[model samples]
Target chain A: MKHFVDTLHISGIREFSEMYINKEDCIFLTIGEPDFNTPTEIKDALKLALDENHTHYPPICGNHELRQRIAKLESMSFFESYTENNVIITNGATEALILAMGVLLGHGDNVMIPTPCFPLYQTQALLTGAEVSNYDTSTHGFQLRYHEFSKHIKENTKVIVLASPNNPTGIVYDEESMITLHRLMEEHPDLYVIIDEVYRSMIYEGEYPSIRDYESTIDRVILVQSFSKTFAMTGWRVGYAVAQESLIKQMNAFHQNLVTGVATFIQEAAITALDVDTQFMLDEYDHRRKYLLKRLALMDVDYIRPEGAFYIFIDIRKYGMDSYTFCKQLADELGVVIIPGIFFGTEGFARISYGANMDSLENGLDRLDQFIREFCL
Target chain B: MKHFVDTLHISGIREFSEMYINKEDCIFLTIGEPDFNTPTEIKDALKLALDENHTHYPPICGNHELRQRIAKLESMSFFESYTENNVIITNGATEALILAMGVLLGHGDNVMIPTPCFPLYQTQALLTGAEVSNYDTSTHGFQLRYHEFSKHIKENTKVIVLASPNNPTGIVYDEESMITLHRLMEEHPDLYVIIDEVYRSMIYEGEYPSIRDYESTIDRVILVQSFSKTFAMTGWRVGYAVAQESLIKQMNAFHQNLVTGVATFIQEAAITALDVDTQFMLDEYDHRRKYLLKRLALMDVDYIRPEGAFYIFIDIRKYGMDSYTFCKQLADELGVVIIPGIFFGTEGFARISYGANMDSLENGLDRLDQFIREFCL
Candidate 1:
């Protein structure tokens, strides 16, 4: 018997990480979940929602308040004019990504995705019976080159999944690249562009330029973002998508039949997140990113330095071991957990998240240094 | 220009109830939700979860405490043995149904669903690209006629979707029907059964004989139930499914990738719902069920008497209009809102929920009588 669809085999990086890591002692840096508690204001807002009897169903698309907050936030940050009708709150950016693909692609349609990206983009495409073509960025310092991306855009391409402060690699797309990408999107009027800016607030240097900046000029762009990273609310699982009203209508119908809506109480609480608490959490991540980068410099590791987000993709190829084996052996020997690069389809590197507390990071790095000296040498 | 799948159509029930109904005078009987607020204890539990900082990601299957509570509650209620491992909490019974269908049915598989049932069973099948064959129970007073059901069990039939204390008609499948269904299942080893008991606790009559009672002998049954109806926690969006280890394993994988689990605070609150305050809510539903049934009797409406849940399906063919037009005309003219029977795949009928306050029920019924006298005749 066929246990699962052939397309369902598109696996996420975490599966490979799970196989190599031991349960008992591995201090693994595998998952992308934020390590901080949900901000106090967001937590209190959730409590207020519950207290105020916001427990029944809200609108299937989203509650009006949260949608309004999302619209305001998008306009203020990206200068993109969006309305409540143009936004649909989702379970998370994961669901938003899936719904976007479902709305845009039919069977055998092709979607271009960045390699060394979050695996979900490609996985969702396969699940929809759509083919995923990867534009490998490993040689370009894990950055999208316009010519390379242009080569993959063919007649059958229905969508492109782009992530900024890209997952696993942590490289934010430069403005020129984004503009060039936007220009190409304009030429292909039939193609849908899905920009996952889930890590939008976590940028370290240059201002985040959203593809929505081209919205007044471009016809097809969908923005997917989440509170999970920005408010340390991964467990809270709240997110929203912004698109044209026409696209949102179909997404809303999918939302209606999929999960109805996020919990009303959660929606009410998330209003506080979008309005007040996200920046503070992002500031904390910025501090950690600087601290971890300094430590990497001291260790003399070869890394494509991140311009945004809290991950450092340090090359462990010099250590003469595969990324997965190195990650496990390092965790077993050093009492520290860092995800192997193999999970992100980049086998020679390992990704370390600086999202943990200073004490843990300091101690874990010290142990990592000791292990590298003993094992690599 | 085609935005939607060709096979899909917008649900007309939602279209009318949300759009056509007048705000000024609409007294809606089209409610698919319980009228009562979530119980104070459960609400307090939610508050406690927030206060104690339970805002982290719940385990993908569920929190252990809620899983244990579900195991205990359903085991005691149905005379079946279900360990925590056998249960997987979902967003709602809707999600449980979706996940069950996703895991069991690949493309081209056939799932037998009872007609005049909740539209989701068929919708989920459609989403999976599976064929949905209906067994019309309306002819047999909405009871599952074993001989008719058995005849539909051809070689291609992979599953059967059954609802007890049926949704639209409110007829409970009696013990005799359950025994015969069980016998048929015994003969067809390849067929899987998805029994939706979301309304099991709302029943007012003879013992709710669950397929769970035969779990020791039946290996292929999946039981789906919810806290929405029983505890008036519709907005809270928590439900669970119990099945054999093999099925739970596959469903758990999909559930993990789907929503990453239900909200933790809500799960904690639901534990209180299952363990502490369930009986009181069940008794209240029983009371409302009797009162509403009595009112329907006095109103001289032609209806199939409901055995359980808070709804009564009244045959309105006597009203001389289609269910959709009749419901709108009644709501607009008489200030009462009721769902059209066409929403649940049967025409010439309307489903009126009794979960509202007695005063509203009395007033609504009086208006209903007035509408019948003036409009129907």
Candidate 2:
């Protein structure tokens, strides 16, 4: 009977999940869950944690051992030198981003989110009573329109949220774009930069350069990374944010009263995920990414080629229908379910995840090609 | 150094952890963490999940098996019938409460809290920009003062927060008190009730009456429970809330954009925990609870005989020092750590957890007696 805040408009990932779960005959590309199993070494670590009685309350920030491991991992991989004080292991990357926005933005303040972005950023901003300003990248090949981004930054903008090897677009921010943004950040020293590097391990273009590489420009940077995508541990829900110790301390205060810590068993598993040699799936995802992009090209769909992560964003404007309607029709008429681009804030486009198995991918694309021929012709 | 919204406060639990963790010589009686290992059956369930590769994103609300188990368990033990649809599994009980407050309370709304309470209620209220009016129970033997509570209710008072078998006081609300509140709630049809039943299984007294026992109250009552205390699965970080389907839906929406869901392996472990018999520890806590109360009665200290949970609240006003300074001095001189009551608001008292091993409890109390006598004299 009581209505929740207006900000929380979407039901959940379940809303999307419900679309395909019961339909055994349907081929779904709508969900974001990875199809890989959790790496065996990580599973072994979890089993060890369970046997060793590491089931009592973990330290609120996290197990110091896990935090220390994460700190080391960040330093070695991203060249981001951070102590344990700078990392707060969270329930997931979603919580890390939500808490980051809660800590950085105040009522009436604003956060800059590039359109066709994960909806969580805008939703969280609204929940905190903060305004959201969008820079549409739909026309710019699904990459940040730097000039528009610069123009949108105002005095009230307190945070900027960016997903690298981005969610729907899969377009990793180029070094030139990051360098320009880093220089601009120098002028707006007051603004906080929240870069979500959850997809860091899945890049196809030989190691994506992190914003952390520009250490001189990182005083206000808060990097959110996760093991969910890389290790296929999304169900384990272990993620951490790397930032200045001061920012982390504030986030820890929130974490302490909010949720004590991520599950201790899961944290052990995450430590295993971080240290293990499990690039088999990362390479597999890259293969799938390239395969899907080539398929899209062959079908003559106008689209942005994803450089990293396993998703392709295609322009479906030629079909003369919005993405939501097109996706529904495709699913009903062709038995292939894809996520509408409008769900990510861009109309006239659709996102197809390449994370599914080879057989499904081929079949889904065949269904899509037939649907396009019938509808567009 | 940007100040946060002022609602987020550093928890006393963190303070206690910091003081006792690396201090090799000190004994701790402060935190609420359990000492037992997670039960083998529960651990195996988690291990099975890891082995079976259930590691990608689970349904945002929860895995169906876990939710169904929780629903069945609640029905069997508490005699409350709930479908899985009525449950929203959360990261922890803390997030269940957080989402409850976020959904039900609007800006400037008020919620009635019983004082000498878990500081979480106050902090959560502050985050939502709602007013928290305490019903001081210190003077009433650590139970809600219905007269004071009813006086505080106004048009803006939207919800009531109560932790049965409470956190600090460990006193369960009497049947008469529940009846009176139930009647009052009938008069205010619009008011929502958020009950934190995290310690439901920790009760050592008469039959614990959940608000669900009252037929008319079913729709408005939201029951928050955890796997932390009963199963010693605190580090597993799993909890759930059962409410009307509508409230669960709203909470799930808040959950999806915030923390998503509990870790999948952790959820599997929690379901096992729910199924296991807790009679052994429940009886153990009961024995310790009675012994601690008897010891407090013989000493020159002041305290209410707790009927449930695992803490004893002692009035330290006799020492003629403030709660914070007194607790710090007690920790230093007595080599025992106790959380200051000021951390839960108000003054001149200390809350000590009796869940420690019996040897530590006995020794800690002896030192506490000597320190109190020396200072008071």
Candidate 3:
């Protein structure tokens, strides 16, 4: 067995979720997916594809039309000209992230990631025998500060991972941070950046800042996005990577053996998905987010006001308990489930997803308030 | 960039297929999937799952019902008791193979593979930083002879990859070879074998011989099966690996980051897929296999008689051209496409798939006959 396999533990998020998954009457705020079902139009498209017998192996990169649509949409969003050649549809953003890491990092290489980051970044970087250097953003309102970020970049650092509308903390990096990142990339010509924008479409306020804004640095940027969050198609396992043709070519070479592309009919559905308006779901999430924030404010519990995605990072350090203990006790005593921040490379904070239904959110928040009052205040 | 990424090339099979895919009037015998659409029952089940909104992340291992059903079916087939704990549903057999390799092989480890084999076995082993040791089965009827296999085993050899009803050759390993494999496992306590039974349900001859027949060796064997060919669901991207609980645990840990799991609704479809009898597709494949064999015999081309799967490895060495040249010329001159065997780690041979519709296969065979006469003869 490989040493890496031994080092690989199930993600703490999953471990905690599974522990309470079967518990009766438990309200789960641990989901990272949209609670909504896939849009009907997308489902109808998939059904049509099945009827048409699109059940053979798809082209390894992806269906060309889906790639073209993705490329066109991304080009418009990023203000860059990207063609079908610049994209490769993947199993999900997870596979896309791993593919990017696999192509760019190897043994003894260093991948600089922001903490509290998605755990997959660390695990995937480690799987490639690359060393992980974490720059903690918890102290700076969950945003990257240039001086602090630069300190973590060693001579061997080959890549930097940034997730806008980040998990655990829903703070999307502002344009200033993106500009600083572009400056850093300019300063370090050898550096590459993997920007995970899986939640790009879920933003509630303002324009999403992308590193692609600086076209000069576009060559080294690997943009990973998914239909999972925006279209509520997580189960469909459709996501894509957009990068320079050279990088896309390398990722495609590796992707050929990684799953031989996503399901063909699903790709067709994804084309329909790109056309479907996600505003309805985003509006619902915004409603829930506002409701939760109001309730939490009334309870006087501190949390980051999430601008995007469906999560709120609640500060539990004041409760004098570690995130794990706080979450475990919350689930056990109140039957409300939330993920520990330790799972996402931070401590003393836990993540509350608002992706659950309003009823669950209202009840879970009430239970959380009760637990906090009884245990802390 | 990782050196391995530099070393990786798109498989020659795909390269050839893509070149001819858009060409007008081309008769392609290059597919490895069943030409039939997925069974109606399975598709309907998927549609129901979608309607019912099973569009969230499934358990990282897989859906419990699907795993339970797979365990039951495999347990009966292998004559060994397997629980859902022993299985991990993957994106496809491609992901399963990579997961197995990622878990078992690391830098400097050796993986012994039989050739001419599926190109993925080698690429995946390389991706793990493991050296691939090929035991060319081409010399001995595409079946591993114990004496020849023994020479490839080194002290650092961690795994042996065997694909029965193999790609290109379409030859199933005999009971004698499996027994010999069991003996080898006994002699080498550290050795593990990965048996790919993706083509198991397509066998035309006697009972599929499995290493699991020797219950004692079951702990050391990892069985990979897929719904792609068997259910004509290649586009669905569903497969599973069955191994001991400990191995499955480690693989699941890796799989969580690989792609989470296959689509939730797709897994539901897979449960229904298991009960849909594949005898109809198998019968069609058998019919095509016999027709192809008879046609090739009439053409006096020396080719292996396929016992399973949908491919026939033809001996084109007599033509005094490399497999690439032979295939390229055949496609160029007659609009018939076949894959070069060198892509599967052997030269001077080409693979002709019978998975094409009868009209295409018949026309392709006619063109093939013309090519042989005009070029080879």
Listed in order, each prediction's TM-score against the native is 0.94, 0.95, 0.97
lDDT of each: 0.77, 0.79, 0.88
Candidate 2: regions farther than 4 A off? A1-4, A11-17, A77-80, A206-209, B1-4, B20-24, B75-80
Candidates, DockQ: 0.43, 0.58, 0.73
Question: Residue A246 deviation, candidate 3, in Å?
Answer: 0.9
Per-residue lDDT of candidate 3, residues A1-377 (tens digit): 26677789888787889898789999999888898888899999999998898888898899999999988988886668899999999988999998999889988799999988888899888887888999888888888778787787888899999899888788899887898789889999999999999988888887777888888888999999999999999888889999999889999998887788899999999999999998999899999989988998999999988999999999888999998899999999999999988889899999999889999998898899999989887
Candidate 1 vs candidate 3: the lDDT winner is 3
Q: What are the per-residue Cα lDDT tens digits for candidate 1 across B112-158?
A: 88779888677667776677898777887676667776787777778
The model with the greater DockQ, 1 or 3, is 3
TM-scores of the first chain across all predictions?
0.92, 0.94, 0.98
Candidate 1 regions with alpha-carbon error over 4 angstroms: A1-26, A77-79, B1-10, B77-80
User: Model 3: residues >4 Å from true position, as ranges?
Assistant: B22-24
Q: When superposed on Cα atoms, how far off is each prediction in RMSD? A: 2.6, 2.4, 1.7
Just chain B of model 3: what TM-score?
0.97
Candidate maximizing lDDT: 3
Could you give candidate 1's per-residue lDDT for residues A211-306 as a string of tens digits?
777754444888898878877777776788888887788877666655667888888888887666466667777787787778878987778788
lDDT at position B347, candidate 1: 86
Winner on DockQ between 1 and 2 is 2
Which candidate has the highest TM-score of all? 3
